[model samples]
Target chain A: DVKVTQSSRYLVKRTGEKVFLECVQDMDHENMFWYRQDPGLGLRLIYFSYDVKMKEKGDIPEGYSVSREKKERFSLILESASTNQTSMYLCASSHPSDRTYEQYFGPGTRLTVT
Target chain B: EDQVTQSPEALRLQEGESSSLNCSYTVSGLRGLFWYRQDPGKGPEFLFTLYSAGEEKEKERLKATLTKKESFLHITAPKPEDSATYLCAPHEDTGRRALTFGSGTRLQVQP
Candidate 1:
């Protein structure tokens, strides 16, 4: 089974605090992604990395940054956490040649910014 | 830009009832289409992956079929435990691995 592990399942922080959400995948997939899901808006992409240390901004990257220092790990950082950033954060990974476009996801981290 | 839309923003059905969820899309070149089932507060779980027009795939009571411009996930005799949010996405024309997702359909199967 493809396993994608997130560092935390839930977190709460104060406004303007810097936060980090970490994820690790064991499948060695080349593509890793971070998305935040909210009511009405659904799942909006924040960022994605195709390889180690390479990242691209998705539709909603503002106030968010990502780091991929190792092939198996990807981290999503909130420069300054705000109440608006409270939502379910999901991490996904997929192989480069996966024509099926199938992405395996972690359980997700629910963040609550006060 | 690739566009994917799912119909019936929400649905409710009795256990053992059968129904279908529709996904309409517009893209530059068809690469692949995906169906995912997401439970509340959890990440979406992969259900089926369909690649070309006229292709279909199935698992248990769920069957996914694709056409030139749309895809359908048919659920048969569903159970209360089968309730979930169904998501559809299109593999973009960009060689890069990025997917554009729909808002999703929230399904409730009551016993």
Candidate 2:
């Protein structure tokens, strides 16, 4: 079975701290995505990588960055954490082929900034 | 913008209740439509994928049907464990990677 795992399920950080949320996928998929889910606003994409070292900004990429140093691993970095950045962060992976449009998501990391 | 919308922001059902959830889209060309069920704290779980009009797929008590402009997920005799937020997304024809998602409908099944 395909599995996606995140580094943490819940995280609390202080303002101005640099936070990192890591994710890994067992399937050698070519696409990885980071999204922040909030009430009323739904899921807003932050960044996505189609391959190692290739990243694209999504609808809400401000104050967030991603790293794809390896095929199985992808990381989301908040350069400066703030209270507004507190939200549930989700990581997802999918195969490159168009057939696998369905993305496999991790359990998610609920971050709280204070 | 590849827009997608889901109706009935919330739905409450009793055990064995039958209902349907709707998802409408206004993209230029429909590449694919996806359905996911998300729990309170966990990520959304993949449920169904409808490719084109007249396409349909079923698993357990849920049946998904598609048309030119919309799709429907029909639940037949739901259970308490089935409560979750249902999400719908439409894949773009060109990129095929990015998906435009709807606001989702929260379903609470009462036992």
Candidate 3:
């Protein structure tokens, strides 16, 4: 079984504060992604990394950034938190090949930006 | 633009009620289609992946079938534990690793 773990299940941050969400996967997958879930928006990708030290912006990447310095770890960074940024953040990892387009997800981090 | 649309935004069913959720998609070329189940306050758990038309996959009481333009997830004699939000995602031919997701259909099964 694949396991993806996030640093925190819940987080609270004040406006303008910097926040970081960490994710680690045990499957040695080369693709990792960050997404935010809202009531009506479903899950929109914020950022994704195909390899260590490589990244790509997704549909809603304006307010978020990601780092993939190591193969098993990926980090999402919010330079300055805002109330509008509060949402359920999810981390997923997957193997790009072998028809493994199915991504394994973590429990998710509910971030509250106040 | 590539898109995925799921219908019957919400459904309420008795324990034994049987129904199906629809996922319609429009993409340049379909690479794959995925289904996921999500509970409140948690991330989505993968359910099925349909790679081509006329394909079908089943698990427990849930069966997924796919066509060129859409997919259907049929639930049979569902239980209370089957209540969750079902999401539909489609991978386009853009060659990117990202998937376009539908808003999802929330299912509620009462005992």
Best by lDDT: 3
Runs in model 2 lying further than 4 Å from the true structure: B94-97
Greater lDDT among 2 and 3 belongs to 3
DockQ of each: 0.67, 0.69, 0.75
lDDT of 2: 0.91
Instruction: Tell me model 3's lDDT, rounded to 2 decimals.
Output: 0.92
Winner by DockQ: 3
The per-prediction CA RMSD against the true structure, in angstroms, equals 1.9, 1.7, 1.4
Score each candidate by Cα lDDT.
0.90, 0.91, 0.92
Q: List residue ranges in candidate 3 displaced over 4 A.
A: A98-100
Q: Write the per-residue lDDT of candidate 2 for residues A1-114, one digit (tens) a residue.
A: 989999999999999999999999999999999999998778888998989999998888889988999999999999999999999999999887764658899999999999
Worst 10 residues of 1 chain A by lDDT: A94-103
Give the CA lDDT, 0 to 100, for residue B66 in model 1. 95
Model 3 — TM-score against the truth? 0.95
lDDT of 2 by residue, B1-111 (tens): 538889889999999999999999998688889999999899988899998899999999999999999999999999999899999988778653467788899999999
Residue pairs in collision within model 1: none
Candidate 2 lDDT score at position B37: 92
